[model samples]
Target: MSRTDFATIDWRGRPVRIECQWIDPERGAGTPLIVFLHEGLGSVAMWKDFPARVCEAAGARGLVFSRPAYGRSTPRAEDEIWDVDFMHRQAHEVLPALFTALKLGDEKPWLFGHSDGGSISLLYAARFPDKVEGLVVLAPHIFVEDKTVANIEIARTAYRTTDLPQKLGRYHDSADSAFWGWNRIWLHPPFRDWNIEAELGTIRCPVLAVQGIDDEYGTLAQIRDIAPRVAGICELLEIPECGHSPHRDQPDRVIVATASFITNNRRQTP
Candidate 1:
């Protein structure tokens, strides 16, 4: 496991500390760099060994980070309320600042994102076409779905009635901040219309979108819709007997597919 470090960046006019780690940092510059973006409730710790395993298999180095409000990074203010554009802010604002702080200037890294992270990856790629190499997204959401809202409602209930808070506490500094930051915005009434299909049309890099056949939060359409919108090569993988979190539900298959996608795409890139 790599040692976690903090990168301080100015966000919304204030300095925010982001927790990050580098996997296989000893690898030469010739090796591709894969940036792993965690899901809504995920953090650097939640990724476990998946990033390292993927980096090893694909002959790449990896970067894993915990977005603000999650993990040991800057926690959300007690009264902070994330709006519908929060993910957009993360992609367009926070990510770029972190890269600048880390001096990753001009290095077009491949992105591996899950769920909300996947959406952010797409937005970043769309907004900065020349700054990304490729993308591998798992259970990405291009638009809100009825099933997604329903599950989020269920999650809200579970957070209060079950041990979900305790489980999330293992990864976040303040479980309430992480939970409410993601939950409230997701369930916010206007968020139902949140969509990014048009933004995807601007992406010029290859994309490999994977989704589980049995995902409770969303259907295969989440990935299926991506194929037609992306301007570049878009591949879809539907894994059977999996759920929202494909990496957790079926790590071996997810790892193999992701590694193969990264390796093949790297070879094809000029």
Candidate 2:
């Protein structure tokens, strides 16, 4: 594995910086590139080394980047309340722009998105199936759940008055940007009307959706709702004793399952 470097990526006329890292395998592995999209509060640093491990396991190149207001990326202003379609913007605008900036269309990368990032990945697959080789999503939210909203309130309180702001600030350049953008929409009554179930039906690639049985934010319906509509090409993996963050809670299973999914389709990358 070679060392990773930081690169400033141009996105939507703004300087939405990103960290792009890749390793050309010594063994000449046939796997397609794997692109990792981060969680709502996640950045390139928050992903830790999971992407590297997955790339190593599946013998693939990896691309990881922070979204607009997280990690080392540029921070949003103090008053940007994210709309319900915020994730859609991330999917349709930011990700594609980043890929275009990097000239990655020719590589046909596979997507690995978690939490909010997973939802973005699903939207991307639906929007650009030809460019996506496959998808591996963890704890993706296709619709809002009662528990999900409940947790958001709890998070709101903690972030507003508690040490959560401080804790999150360490990871995000603008913790307020990350926290408030995700918070207001979640607690908004209108946002409850969100349901990507229709958008997901447009996906035409093989998808591996994983969630923890003990997930605190979403339910099985999150993935199951999309599973039936996706041409029966979706695989649902529910892990026991795991919570919302499957990559952190069950890295071994995540690595194994992701490796299997990526390799299973490696030969079809024509």
Q: Residue-wise lDDT of candidate 1 within 1-270, one digit each (tens)?
A: 466789999887678899999998888677899999999999999999999999988989899999999999999987789998999999999999999999998788999999999999999999999999999999998999999999999999999999999999999999998999999999999999999998999998999999999999898999999999999999999999999999999999989998888777774334
Highest TM-score model number? 1
Give a tens-digit lDDT track for model 2, residues 1-270: 744555566654657676565655443435568888888778887888888889889888787878887877777766566788899998888887888877655667789999999999999998887788889999999888999999989998888788998888888877888778778888889999898888777788889999999999999888777788785378889999999999999999999999998777555643
Give the whole-model CA lDDT for all candidates, comma-separated. Answer: 0.92, 0.83
Stretches of candidate 2 off by over 4 Å are 2-13, 23-30, 268-270
- Residue pairs with colliding backbones in model 1 are none
Relative to the true structure, candidate 1 reaches a TM of: 0.97
Write down the lDDT that model 2 would get.
0.83
What is the C-alpha local distance difference test score of candidate 1? 0.92
**Alpha carbon lDDT at 98, candidate 2:** 81
